[model samples]
Target: MKLLERILKYQIVTSLCVLTLGAVLFYFSVDYLIDREVNKELMRSKAKVSWQLRHINELPVYILQLGDSLQLDQVRYPGQMALVERKLFNEFENEYQPYRQLIFYERVEGAWYRVTISKLLAQRQQLLEAVVMTVTFIVALLLISLLLLNSWLSRRLWRPFYKTLRALDSYQVEKHEVLTFPKQHTVEFEQLNQSVTHFTDRLAATYQNLKEFTENASHEIQTPLAVILSKIEGLFQDESLKESQLVALSEISEAANRLAKLNQALLLLTKIENRQFLAGTEPISLVPIINRKLRDLEDLIEQRGITVKTAIEPTGPVMHPALAEVLVNNLLTNAIRYNVNGGTIDIALNAGKLVVRNTGAPIHIDPELMFERFRKEGTHSASLGLGLALAKTICQVNGQTLTYETDGPWHILTVTW
Candidate 1:
């Protein structure tokens, strides 16, 4: 979830809970206050009735109405007053409505009289509801306003942080550039910007140093390797060498050759990883590359007496021409090198995908380890096993997928973008 969405979700839930509590409290408070006001009005009606009874020498009947009632009865307790709420059935309305009752005793002409005054509370109840609803509506309106305001403010406040996030997402260590984040007033956002800038600067520096070292080492090692191979070639012309001495020299030559091949493979891998093969700007066809490689290896294919079949549809995938050549060469090399004698090689390309299958013995190694550097099949005894690794690296760098699978007696290597 997005950070702002989570914050908004949490804020809405908390605000609802608070609004519910406040609404309940507001409802009860308005009911209580309205009841107090109603009670005071009822007490004033009682007093006015008492004044009329004392001066006019008759019971006060004007205070009573259709929805209200007053009653006087002789009582033992005097000077006591109380109010209570009750529901009474109205014969005229044919329904029950709430009423407020004021019960009190007063000494009138030396006799104790209990006066009961009851008033219909339907209007007061409506007034209480209106007050509560108005307050709740206002509270809800304020809550909605706060939510909108918070969303707007949060978007504005986090603008700089989001800009920094987008920059970091696209930052590449190989790119020789520094990120320039916008200035932010928030302490946390400023800290994040500083941390990312420092970290990427360090990473770019480290990558540059490592790249220089690999290139230097590869270059330095090549000179010595060439000298050693040349001196060994010179030693081959010495006729005085014994048979055992010749065998020793042959072993040394094989070891040196392997070392040279290993060094070239490592250097190629480093270059692929460093994106050094991105210099070529050409639209290359996989079909042409495949056909050229097949022709180059036609001698070996005929010597092995292998049958080749091709089903190619012309495609133009834009890539570095040299990388494209290396990709096809590695795949074809592995297919030919590891195939059975007089086996079949099938090449298919269409719709931006290429599949090369060769008849070979079932491979027993973990399928996942097949692309690792120095991983080899059991039968390819003289192989260094970096061919498929290099192919996979090239595919990755060029935004393609390389996968290996075993289909019966055929080993299938597929490249797709």
Candidate 2:
């Protein structure tokens, strides 16, 4: 499901479940309350009937002397005849004691007369109607409140996420575009916005670098090819034997070699930039890699009469052996390439910091531009100029920082964790 739809679906289901539970509970509670009130009214009526039956003698005297002359027993009442057919004797019975129904049987001039005194019971149909009405009213009011509350809560909770979703829909990566989401009141949504912003920024940077790399590679390759073609065409124009022509051929060959090297370097940089070298993690030691790279460049260092020093600390372990090797190799190559013929190279490693210093001419290029692709400093312009750039990319992928500085005649490079 789409993210917003999923969120809304869960919210709605939860609200409905809660509302249903509340309604069931309310139904039982109201039923109990109404039942208690009806019972109380019935008890009050029974008490009145009991009081009149306790004074039966006075009741008969009052009933006879009332000027109306029609006695309660002499009249053939509908309810009275029904009670008589049931053989309802006029006597106080234990079964009626609880509800206070009293029946008095008396001999008045040798004729039997029965008097029934009982509280009127409510009809079963009336009780059923009352329960139905009360429950209907309560349920109606509860449902209305539940709907209103559900709407208000759902709108309030999902408002920010909806805005974020809309912003993401309109985002375009090709245009180097991003939509900034507002800070959400909820912690989870705020964290989501931060992660998305970081991802987009990195994507834009990688895309720009790829574009520049393609353009630079095309131009570098074309330049050497054009030179080789022109030299070949000039050689065909005249079958001449001259030292200058031989030198021109050698120069063309060297240019072709340089172009090939540049292509290989560019490919390697692309692979590293895309993080294709990330295999499974393995423990690696930095000292051995650094020492190995320095030894590989020993011949050049000795021929130039440069002094080399090392102060590597024994590290416990590290992940990504190949990455460490690449980083150390690139830094060492750059240091050797840019140093003076009879200068010094100093390498130090201690407390998670690696410092490489070389005695060289002061750099005239911008330090900020030094780590950029195709950027070259003075007198070392023949180099491919991507060694330090590759080193920087390696540091970034491995969660390290590569910084450069100039101290007098020494150029210092530092890598820190």
Against the true structure, whose TM-score is highest? Answer: 1
TM-score of each: 0.81, 0.46
Candidate 2: count of backbone clashes, pairs at least 3 residues apart or interchain:
3
State the lDDT of candidate 2 residue by residue for 15-121, as single tens digits: 56776677667766666665565455434433443355454533433332111111225222223221211222233342321222334443344444455444322
**Candidate 2: pairs in clash:** 90-103, 90-105, 91-103
Off by more than 4 A, model 2: 1-241, 279-283, 316-319
Candidate 1, clashing residue pairs?
none
Residue 182 displacement in candidate 2 (angstroms) = 23
